[model samples]
Target chain A: MNDTSTRAPATRRGKGLLPLALGMVLGALAMLVGLAEAGRLKPREPQTVVALGQLLDAEHRRVDLMLERGDMAGAIEALEALREQPWPDHEAGGDVGMQLRHDVYGRLLRLRLDHPEVLPVEPQALLRIAEEGLGESYRELDINPFTARLAALRGEVLEQLDRDDDALAAYVEALDMNSALLDRELAEEGAK
Target chain B: MGAGALLGLSACTAKAPLTAPAGGVDESAAGGDRDDASLRAADLSSLELELDRSWEELRTLEDSREPASVEAGAAGPGDVVDRCERIRGLADRICVLSDRVCALADEHPGEERYTSACGRGRDTCTQATEAADRCAAG
Candidate 1:
């Protein structure tokens, strides 16, 4: 009876210690997780940076070659094909995808504007293309000449549509972006 | 080598043989100063033609590399140091040719024809530069 009674406390004590130690370990883990997620550390994007360079290169060249051969319709068709490509979102595809879309759309618009007879797209249709190309999230992407170009082309399309007020506004937006880019480039050059 | 080093080396790509200065008149063949001047003009025209031809060759090469690069491979992977070396070489050739055209236009002042040639040369340079930059960035 004495041995049983003595060992009972020790067994209870051991059981108590196991839960306490496990709780301490779990509590420590939760604290570390909370600290890490408090915005001190930048959360990496869920997707890796998209590398669409080779894809863009080939598409760009294919269009260039078509233009070089004086095949305006062919060039326009090729660009339309590019537009149909399965593009990932900004988070998934990164800024390059956005930049490339801008470039592709800009060229398509420019060609349609320059050779309207080739593609025979109406001004209203062209405006839709421009608006669609500059998606809702475009403003959030990094400022780049391709984006600026798409913006400028949007202005041109607006002008053709006779929305002079809207055209001016678009031009102003593009100009502001371009001037900032120029200033940064000049600063970099000066520093160099 | 590094991409930067490849770009640098490409910048020094050998000048086209046709880019040889058209100076030093062959008085023996011309037999007169006016004729020598005419010969120089001929030489300039010939150089411009050759430069245009060379530029086209480089452009064609650049075009040929485009078909399967995005779909298949750039002949293979491009994660290595010398990845865009071929692109740099093509761009360099076109760049040098365009520069020669610009120089020729500059040397002979007051020629309206050269003004147009210079404009085209500038366009070619811009295209080549953009291509090189895009390729290297990849």
Candidate 2:
């Protein structure tokens, strides 16, 4: 009887300890969760910053569509609006922002040269924007394809402005760069 | 016990379950789609060359003062109609090519390389064709 009574109490006490231990664990978990909510831990990873790139791409396409419809004024308006946008503060070497800016400037310059009547700015101003927008930073990054296209557009602008010699030089430079890009792309294709 | 050790190890190594992207295509399938897109980007330089030549001729015409002398250099106003017709022909071919590339890129939507290449080519073709129409009109 005594043995049975002692063992019974001991088993009951063991059962009681389990609830206590479980409570302690749950409380600790709640506290840890609270700490996380309070941001004691490292911040969560940022949402993927892709929307800006997408918006720029869509806008570029819209400009193309407008141009296709011979809506010169509409195209100019869109291109100018795109140019006025603040360049995204993307991480260094991020190509999206660079490509977006270059595309906008290149297209704008083309529009200015092709349809000066539609452009709000002078052709010279548009040329200047292209020169500055497609600067050495893109070259430093070795984005040769875009650089080549921009150079070609610059040549066209120069030609329109009657700077034939400078235009010729720019065109030659663009041809060389494009040749290099083609070779590189072909080599990559071959490797693949 | 060995079982206890295994359980502890499993708990330590636990990870969230993998989930497919919103569109339901999993990573491997997406990679396969990119591979297909790569095929579409191949050997576009030849098309680019054709566009470049037409563009240069247009520029030459725009730059020239003496229409006759420019005609000698490029398509004369009579030749302009012919050259513009040729450009429109190329644009037709490019339209087909662009459609193929875009369709391939659609298999892996949002892949930047595919999107950019396809879009660039398509835009170039569209603009070139439109310019040719203007050249013809003039």
The C-alpha stretches of model 2 lying farther than 4 A from their native spots are A1-49, A89-93, B1-138
Which residues of candidate 1, in runs, are more than 4 Å off? A1-51, B1-138
Best by TM-score: 1
What C-alpha lDDT, on a 0 to 100 scale, does residue A88 get in candidate 2?
47
Worst 10 residues of 1 chain A by lDDT: A1-10
The sequence of per-residue lDDT tens digits that candidate 2 reaches over residues A1-192 is: 011221222232233455333332332222223323434211121111123433554565465456557677887788678767666433431433454456557656766666667746755876787787776556543433345557777866676676655655565555445444434433543576
TM-score of the A-chain for all models: 0.72, 0.63
Per-model TM values vs. the true structure: 0.45, 0.43
Report the poorest 10 consecutive residues by lDDT, candidate 2 chain A. Answer: A1-10
Model 1 lDDT per residue over B17-119, tens place: 1122223333233433344345445444433433333222322232232323323434321223232454454445445445544555565577766566557
Best of the candidates, DockQ: 2
Chain B vs. true chain B: TM-score per candidate: 0.39, 0.39
By TM-score, how accurate is candidate 1? 0.45
